[model samples]
Target chain A: MNQVIETLLQHRSIRRFTDQSLDREQVETIVKSAQAASTSSFIQAYSIIGVTDQEKKDKLAELAGNQAYVAANGHFFVFCADLHRHKIVGDLESADVEDSIESTEKFMVALIDAALAAQNSAIAAESMGLGICYIGGIRNDLEAVKEVLKTPEHVIPLFGMAVGYPDQETDLKPRLPLEHIYMENEYQQDQSLFKKQLQDYNKTTSEYYEERTGGKRADTWTGQMAKMLGRKSRLYMKEFVENQKLNKK
Target chain B: MNQVIETLLQHRSIRRFTDQSLDREQVETIVKSAQAASTSSFIQAYSIIGVTDQEKKDKLAELAGNQAYVAANGHFFVFCADLHRHKIVGDLESADVEDSIESTEKFMVALIDAALAAQNSAIAAESMGLGICYIGGIRNDLEAVKEVLKTPEHVIPLFGMAVGYPDQETDLKPRLPLEHIYMENEYQQDQSLFKKQLQDYNKTTSEYYEERTGGKRADTWTGQMAKMLGRKSRLYMKEFVENQKLNKK
Candidate 1:
């Protein structure tokens, strides 16, 4: 396998990081690489905030489910789906950007653009010998995050990422088999074979967690998902998105 | 800058690819790298369909808004926001996976997961001297793509990617200014400054396109967005997503 392919295949989220600060040049390079990712329609409706202040990090850590690793990471970036820039474009051109910006499709473009750019940033950081973890817990308190970050209307925080040198090595988490996902020319409804493959993967995941977490065997993929569903993790997201002036076409 | 960073920074969407086939080992490597991407709660709610069959490619090209490049590209992968695996898991465990799988939150997770994995694949492919272009037009006829790809319910085609050696060298596409995106902590809403910067970028983009396309003169960023917004894109995404059993309790 190619080196890049090998590196990607062996990727594991690093929650623990060494106390090493990334150089400014390195950060700039990663951000530049991020900016280079393809944006839908070239709108580039995304922004990233680099969080360096320890106090603010502490506050953000609290907001994000008390993830200590977020506080200790060398660099933290909050990725936002931003339509504020287009609003500026409208202001300059004296054109009504409101008609276009207030639709669900526009909001989705921004969200997907943010995700694509962040994924590029992650890949760029990994290539530079940095370990990274995404903090979806940022959505835990969307309102508080908005206030803390002072996000303007039309800009919503989608997620956070922690980047730094790895403190420990980890195993690659296994995934479902390709057959479970790779379809031919139509949507297939074959469930029996897919179930068998997933059962084997569940066993693999359960055993891995058991060995790694030192007997703290978390639920299999199915059980964890069941628990997650009941958690209503994104209950606030809809209202938050609506409040941000999205989905208001 | 690191070599990988340089490569990433210099990335351009190469829609026109040479008539070369990717080896099986190369395909395996790219897919493995994709599998290594981060998944929300490790549910890994995404998958890719690799299309090498010529007839299938022709049909896909037609379905994806008649993009001839797709049929001629070396490799085409359709990324899907998939929850079907979890449904199968639920059935085996006799768990209420339907409840878990049927939510906007789950849909978002699946979409993000699919996008992140696809980004990884793109980066890995780029590092290996291949070029890629994302085909967002796949959503033009989402139902047709689902049917053509044999996608089961709960698996929406998010986007398609065409990859191969570049048949032509394209210049890098310009993005909005860094200040427009890389905010400090809060979103900066200085409309005047943003407009000035974007106007400058518009000029830069115009120049870049002029040079790259030999005076085929694409519209400025704002103009393009205005034209795009005027069009009726994503016509059936809402109903399609609903039909996939998402966004429901």
Candidate 2:
């Protein structure tokens, strides 16, 4: 395997971080790397809030499911799907702008752009000897997050991330078998082979979770998935998204 | 600026590629970098279909708005939002699985995951001295793509990308001003300030595009957007998504 391939294959979500802080130069590098990612038609429909204020970090930690790691992380970033820029451009050109910039395609483009940029930043960070973890709980209270961040209309917070040096070494979490994901040209409905692979992976996951939790095995992948599928995390997302002037379609 | 940062800042869409082919190791490294991107909940709800066959590439080129570069490119990759794996996993565990896996959240996760992975692969390719371009026209004939790829149910083809050594050098495309994107804690809806930035950027972009196309100044940012906003481009996406068993909610 190539060196980069080996490094990527060993990826793990790092939650525990040393107290070391990222300097301005490092932050600029990561952000520049993120801005380099491809955007749909060069619209660049996304934004990042670099959070370093201790008070704000404490507030954000409370907002994001009370995750202490987030408050203490050296470099925290909140990624947003933004369309306000276009709206502003429209106004400047004397173009008639929609009151709300929500359409299926537009929303999809913004969300995808944010995710792509964030992923690039993550990869660049890792390449520069940094550790990182994504915080999806930022959406737990969409309204509160908006108010806290003072986000304008036509933009919605998608996710948050913490970056810093590792405080502890952790094992890479195993992924689903290749066959489960990589299909031929079209989708194959062959479940028999897929099931076998999942079963093997579940056993591996069960043992790992058991060891981590020290005697508690939280069911297998199936059980956990079942529990998760029914749970409503972004219950207010529809209304919230609309309030942000998105997804009007 | 760091050399990597400079590379990223100067990124331009490379629609032209040389005849040089990528080695297996290079392909594998890009794929691995893609797999390493942060997936929502580690579901990894995406896959890449590597299209090396000329016949398939030619057909795909036609399907994607007859983009000549796609067929001529050294390597073509189709990134998909995939949930077929979970269906198989459910079968193996004897878990009650829904026939359709469409939900707004699931669809969002898959789309975001696909974009994230693809972005990582793009950056990795750049790091290894390759140029790339993303083709969103794959959605033009979604059903045709599915049929050609033999894609099973519950998988949506999102985008295609052409990657290889650049046959011609291109300058970086300018972006929207920073003030338009980087928001503070909350979103600021200051319209005047945003308009000013857009006006400046529009002038910059007008020159850039005019030079690239060798045409008298065509559409500015606002003009281009006005033209695109209402243009119906195969946006039966809602129905298409629902058909894939996604966005049920």
* TM-scores for every predicted model: 0.93, 0.90
Query: Which one is best on TM-score?
Result: 1
Residue B118 displacement (Å), model 2: 1.0
Per-residue CA lDDT of model 1 for B109-135, tens digit only, reads: 787788888888888889889999988
Model 2 segments more than 4 A misplaced: A1-10, A94-100, A207-220, B1-7, B94-101, B210-215
Q: Candidate 2 on A31-80: residue-level lDDT in tens?
A: 87788788887768899988877888888889888998889877999999
| Best model number under lDDT | 1
Q: How does candidate 2 fare on TM-score?
A: 0.90
Q: Which ten residues in a row have the lowest lDDT in candidate 2 chain B?
A: B92-101
Q: Quick one: best DockQ, which candidate?
A: 1
Interface RMSD of each: 2.4, 3.3
Q: What is the lDDT of residue B72 in candidate 2?
A: 90
lDDT of 1 by residue, A1-249 (tens): 565665677678899998998888877877887899888767788899988888888889999889998899879999988887777666656676786676656776787788889988987888888999999888888888888888888888888999999998888777767565555445555666666667776787788789889998855766676566545566556567778887445
